[model samples]
Target chain A: MSESYEATVTDPVSAPMTCDSNPVEEWLRMDRMPHIWCPGCGIGTSVNCFTRAIEESSLDRKNIAIVSGIGCTGRVAGYLLLDSFHTTHGRALPFATGLKLASPKTKVVVYSGDGDLFAIGGNHFIHAARRNLDMTVLCVNNFNYGMTGGQVAPTTPEFAIASTTPYGSVERPFNLPYLAQSCGAVYVARWTVYHVKQLQRSIREALEKPGFTFIEMVAPCPTLFVRRNRLGDGLAALESYEENAVIKNGADTRECDLGMGGPIVCGKFVDIDRPSYLSNQVAHLRKVLGDRYVMPDAWQGVVQ
Target chain B: MNADPRGVLTGSHFLDGDHAAAEGALAAGANFSAGYPITPSTEVVERLAGRFPFTGGTFIQMEDELAASIAIQGAVWGGSKALTVTSGPGFSLMMEHLGYGIMTETPFVLVDVQRGGPSTGLPTMPAQADMMQARWGSHGDYEIIALAPSSPQECFNLMIRAFNLSEKYRTPVLLMMDECVGHMLERVVIPSPEKIQIEPRRYTRKGPDEQYWPYSLEECNNGDLVPPLTKVGEGHFPHITGLTHDDRGYPAMNAKSQAVLLGRLVDKIRNNADDIITIEEDGTDDADVIVVSYGITARVCQPAISRARAEGHKVGFLRLVTVWPFPEKRIRELAGRVSAFVVPEMNLGQIVREVERCSQGRPKVRGVTHAGGAVHDPEEIYNAIREVMG
Candidate 1:
């Protein structure tokens, strides 16, 4: 329905590495190739940035988990070459919460979408943040629910046309960074899929934090959200980021509500510290129960 | 294996069924539980919270049953035996994650204390009505192991078996306790750590870098009915999904994928139903009437069955300990000889249907139904037996 500037980009011809030597190939399920993401869709771009970020992060590939809920972004887990859990709709946080509390060592990341994260799963998002659970939450905000065909979402901007809101969305949208920050997330950041380097760096930084941290990448649903709302193609949407993106490092999150095609305030804001759920549980139980409390030993289930 | 000594009470005590279930979980080496308080099931958490401090276990009061159910699955993959308990309304809230546990083959215990309900019908009363829901509540084609306990002592004893089955088969084993038994007071004996045998989780033998197939139905040397699983953090890098998955644990949606994954999910319990099912049968060999019952209803039917036998009416009792994998094969084989089956349950006829289906119309199947606030009267069961005998 729409077209944007196509990249005249090409990879430089170089010595090709075999599958065993290539980290990207090693970390991806090649059998599930030709991903479902439409051409020029921003989710694939976001995933590419994530893989690059994984390559850069200090965590081992085997110790990181990618958990997702039901949505387009939810498919992120199946494509990755890590231990992932594709759980029920809006239930990813609680599932990831269990995994983190049980293992206490895996770097758990929830990669989901706007509708899945802030809509049906809103309660879990706030509670997980309030508990300061030790995990990373990455939400790819495409302005609407992309999987079920562009329905109006909790994060859908005011007056935006969606399948449910044929006239336009009358409800004011939630500024996810503000919500996560207010709910006690230790770190909060926002970027676009177009800002690949910045997004990857922010993800790496969030992964390093020991308590609840959240990163929002504003992506484009060129197939549905863009075509339905007349918002141009995904590349044009990316270019819109180039034109309207403002690097506001410490802007008040209260003023960060995104518009249909307005200035996007992006940066790492609200980076602080708090004791995670397990750390506090361990400390409090030791003090109260004392000698009676047996420290949990993670020895028995470790595979050779 | 013996229980961790700290968790074992190693003495006889008068505890309610709910409390016995909690103690039994700890004695069976359950190190984690996530639960939300609901009627008839709250005492399980009440007991666990008080006892977990000394037992090296963790009990978290989750936000809701949805969180509680899925949270235990996390604990299972985190490297501990785990469980969650709830009542009817909360149990309904857990069906989705219940399916998740079945699909992912995660081993965790879910104890549903039966309160009467289509919707909060009897919050504080007993019902064996959830008997069908336990077997068919989750959406999809799958089978699960569900056990019903008639007395507080069996609640303690069977709670251990529940966890053992969860580990042995890598599935969510349902401890389907009803309100009557949950609140019922009886003497429960806690065995010493050495005398108690607990099945440790069947962990993966594959090395960290080895290709650990989470759902491979292939044969290991020991011939485990279920595949062993590795901890999420132990460098397995395995992927788990509720979708119909292949051997590698990746979601593959197709006819072939469904057949491979769902076929095993149902067969893992069905193929081993012989080991999973336990029942108490008496005089069924030569009885004209067999009274089929479970949970507190089974206990209620006992005196009635005994009185019928005393009068020389040729009555017998068939008590179900594992209500699901519903002893159909045995019932089918017995139908040829017995004149009738008298099924007395708290709910208005749930398990009776299973009995009817398996009977193949060989003998008359009579349902002695109740609305479920209270247990069936002894005379009611006795009358059903006499009528069936006539």
Candidate 2:
């Protein structure tokens, strides 16, 4: 055979493209692929950033466990190649809280969506932060509930059209960063799908923090949020985020609220040190019991 | 297997049922518990909170019952033997997660210190009304093992059994305690660790190099139908979900997968009913009338049974220890010979329906129903037995 013909047959560059060549493929359940995400949905992009963050973090893959509640983002747990749990709707924070307490050496991440984390699971989110549980919560905020059609969510900005609020929502939306910071989260950040590098960096930083860390990634629900509000397609939504998002690290979280068709504030808002729930518990018990206090079996080597 | 000695108190003490249940959990080698404070059941967690620090156990007071229920499951996945305690209102809130546990085949114990309720009817009062709720509250066709403890001693004894059955079957086991039993003080003897047998969690023996499926029946080696569990950091990379899943524990939302998954979940408990069901019988060999009772009512029926026996009636007594597998075989066998069954319980007619169904019209079943707050009078139960034999 001629040299050109041999090169065409033998070169990897001329081979048919497969997902096996993708770097993130190792972190995902490729067997379960053909993911359920809809066309132009931004959740897949956020997940890509998450896989990159996991790769960059110093934590061992075997020592990391991901938990998710019922929503479109909840499916992230099932797709990840790790010890993952798809828990009951609105219970991911508490589930991860228990996992962290039981295996203090394991890095537990609660990956869920706006409605699953804020509406039904709102109480757990607030309490987990208030207690300063050692876990990271990555909330993919698409504004409305995307999994169950575009229903009005707690994070849905006022005057945005949703299936449950076809006449337009009148209730004010929750400012998530402000909520997390006020509830005693040691690390809080916000970014959009368009800001992939920043989002991945924020996730890595949050993973290294001890106490409860919250990161809100504002993504697009083109089939619902964008289409219903006439905000164009997913690409248009990313362009809008690129055009309007302001990066102001250390900005007061109270001023970080998002309104309908308004500028999106994106940056780290809170980073501080606080004793986590388990550490506080151990410290208090050791003080009271003195030599009688024995570290829990799971925390024997990890604590102290 | 023997329990861990650190968890065993190993002494005799006058304790309430709730406290004894806590000691029982410790003796069973439960290293983690998450619970919320509710009426009557609060003492169980209160005792655990006071003792867990010393025994190398972790007890968390979650925000609500829903959180507590799911938190224990997370701990189980993280390689801790875990449990959660609550009362009627809180137990209702935990129904969804109970179904989640059953769907995932997660082994954990739930202690429901029963109080009167459709919705918080009587918080501090005695009631056996939640018995049916414990069996059927979760919305699914699944079987769960539920045990009723009649005294503080039984509370300590049965909790260990509850944990063992849960691990053996890989299902949630309910420790059903009424307000009376939860609050009643009695002498409880806690055996030494060597004397107490504990079934360790059936963790998969497969190494990281081998493929391990979370729900694969092919991995079942003990002939019990339960697939061994895998811990989070074990490198099994198991995917556990509440959705109907295939043997690999991945969501298989189709009719065939649902049938296989739900069928196994139900059959694991039902098929093992012979080994799982426990009942106490007296004078049942030759009797014209049998009185059925459980929980506090079982103790109440004792005096009534003695009164009927004194009157020369061939009255037999049956006390249910494991209420859920319902002791159907024994009840049916006795029903073929007995003329009637007198069931005196605190509820309107919960387990009596089971007795009636099991008898299959072979015997007349009478339910001596009381609507909470107090135990049945021995005279009332005696009269029911007399009426059945009159």
Candidate 3:
């Protein structure tokens, strides 16, 4: 507790945020600001849209919990003034699933980057969706590992350049919308960071929806992915990025896969009602135990 | 805090070490468990799944050891006392999250029902091989509390101690039960809820208006108990990460910061070793040879010590209940008094090394070895004692 080893905080974030008139400021830890994100990074835009969605959502503010894995998108947990867990890399979903199961009423969200979700934690993603868990997963697909120097990602387009794939990636990218839909997500949506209003509205809608909602935000990693691929930086990348993106609300999830320099289909592809893991588990137990089965009051019977 | 009556079966029951451990967790006020079924540890989960529906407890069958381990951490931060059970292979998988939980300072219990293995050596058989693994398996220099039970009764009793230690320290407490002890059945007495004491998580006193730091200990009035824990839903906006962090729990990237962070992590356990370290000794006075053992091996040492005593060779028994702090000071004192220390274990040698290290070449230390398919023969242990005495 002494001042024995206080390191000179080289990048002590700008002066502590004072009482502010800004609404986003009310919901964010602005002192933790001047964030680690590069100047033209699309991650900050995605965070802006998310904070706006939280502001506009009808749910109680006290019931929200945010979880994030390791990456640029993962820092959202640190920025948000909500109950957040900055869990280990590729583990945000499982950790979020545990929180949702234990505190069923709390709305949990897993916000992370493409590599953290689809590469190391893809198995957990499929199983959580398959179970129809009552939570939302916001995957920011930046097409490369922004935190660990722009390595190629599962969502990176084939023939695109990355630090690991200096000569161009030779692998197929996972079409997230199709992946979420096929994995049994109750609601699936996608939008680029450029679509501010639409993206925020889509997040709000997903937040309202139940059972494994997934929203993939195609953000630009201007510092890493953009520079390495010779794509224009800052807003220039957003103006011309994923240019083939087409709005398709009800396209077949299979055909919605993103290909190299091909049409990028994005929309609220799947929205349907399905009982979540907790609800179904409760119902099944009730039917079997009848009056013997007692439902635990909130936060009583934590998930196994 | 007292045990929840709904979860406690307050009566004597004949139960195996694994089942006793499950009951112990319930009586210790653990409301949540996430685990993958593995041999020797499966009964702990199976018992909980069937019992939780009726006892207001929740048991989640996780996909793998990786999920099972981290899931418990989430539950803990969500204001629940949680734990996960696994054996050798699964315990190996849990190593990473064990480190994760330590770095984040999340309190939880993990029962590693020890089985023989460098890699899946024996599935159903017992091994005390994980003693070293429990101490150092997880990468990094953080400390953990571990317990070894010699019987089903101790399995139930020590489980509460394990949970209490974990709650008190905000560290992962390992109940290192070997396969033999986990499977062997015996009479276990469950006390009434009021009779069983449980450690409630210490919550910070600083109000919401005050800037709360998760690791700030300027107000830590007690040394045994670390900083008070703030739950995730408590609106503290508490940010915890696995990265080397400051007292605010914010990740810091420099070694000077890392040095301070790592120092606290290590010292929290090291400084409180006196209160955390526990060992049981019997018949040590005027003894020429003392046998050190734990888990089922401790029970196995009973006959060996008795045989040595019958032959008029002064023999003693030293049982390890809390293994992580290693009880080095106690071993050092005994080494100067006893002529030799004989250790018999299911593995070729694991904890015997600790005995050797603590002995400091002061006394002859010998080990009775086995490949772990079966328990050590009492006759072989008796011979080892005689040999060490000579």
lDDT scores in order: 0.86, 0.92, 0.85
The best candidate in terms of lDDT: 2
Worst 10-residue lDDT window, candidate 3 chain B? B218-227
Candidate 1 residues lying further than 4 Å off, grouped into runs, are A1-23, A299-304, B219-225
Pairs with backbone N, CA or C atoms under 3 Å apart (clashes), candidate 1: none
| Candidate order by decreasing lDDT | 2, 1, 3
- lDDT (Cα, 0-100) at B327 in candidate 2: 89
Candidate 2 structure quality by residue, lDDT tens digits, B1-390: 999999999999999999999999999999899999899899998998889888988999999999999999999998889999998899999999999999998899999999888897999999999898899999978898999999999999999999999999999999999999999999999988999999888888899868999998777756568998998898999999999999999999999999988888888888899999999988999999999999989999898899889888899889999999888889989989999999999989999999999999999999999999999999999999888876
Which lDDT tens digits does candidate 3 get at residues B1-390? 888787889999999999999999989988889899899799999998888777766778877888889888888877888889999999999999999988888889999898888897789888878888889998888788898888999989999999998888888899999888889888999999999999988887767656678888877876533778877655577887888888888778899998887787788899888999888889887778888888888887788788778878888888888888888988999999988999888888888998999999999999888888788889999888877766
* Worst 10-residue lDDT window, candidate 2 chain A: A4-13
Which consecutive 10 residues in model 1 chain B have the weakest lDDT in total?
Answer: B216-225
After superposition, the stretches of candidate 3 with alpha carbons farther than 4 Å from their true spots are A1-23, A299-304, B206-210, B222-225
Q: How many backbone clashes does candidate 2 have?
A: 0
Lowest summed lDDT window (length 10), candidate 1 chain A: A1-10
Per-prediction TM-score? 0.95, 0.97, 0.94
A1-304 per-residue lDDT for model 2 (tens digits): 3553343233434557776477899999999988898766889998899899989989999999999999999999999999999999999999998898889989999999999999999999999999997899999999999989999999999899999999999999999999999999999999999999999999999999998999999999987898789887777899999998999999999999899888899999999999998889888899999999978888987876
* Deviation of model 3 at B147, angstroms: 0.1
Task: Grade the docking of candidate 1.
Answer: medium
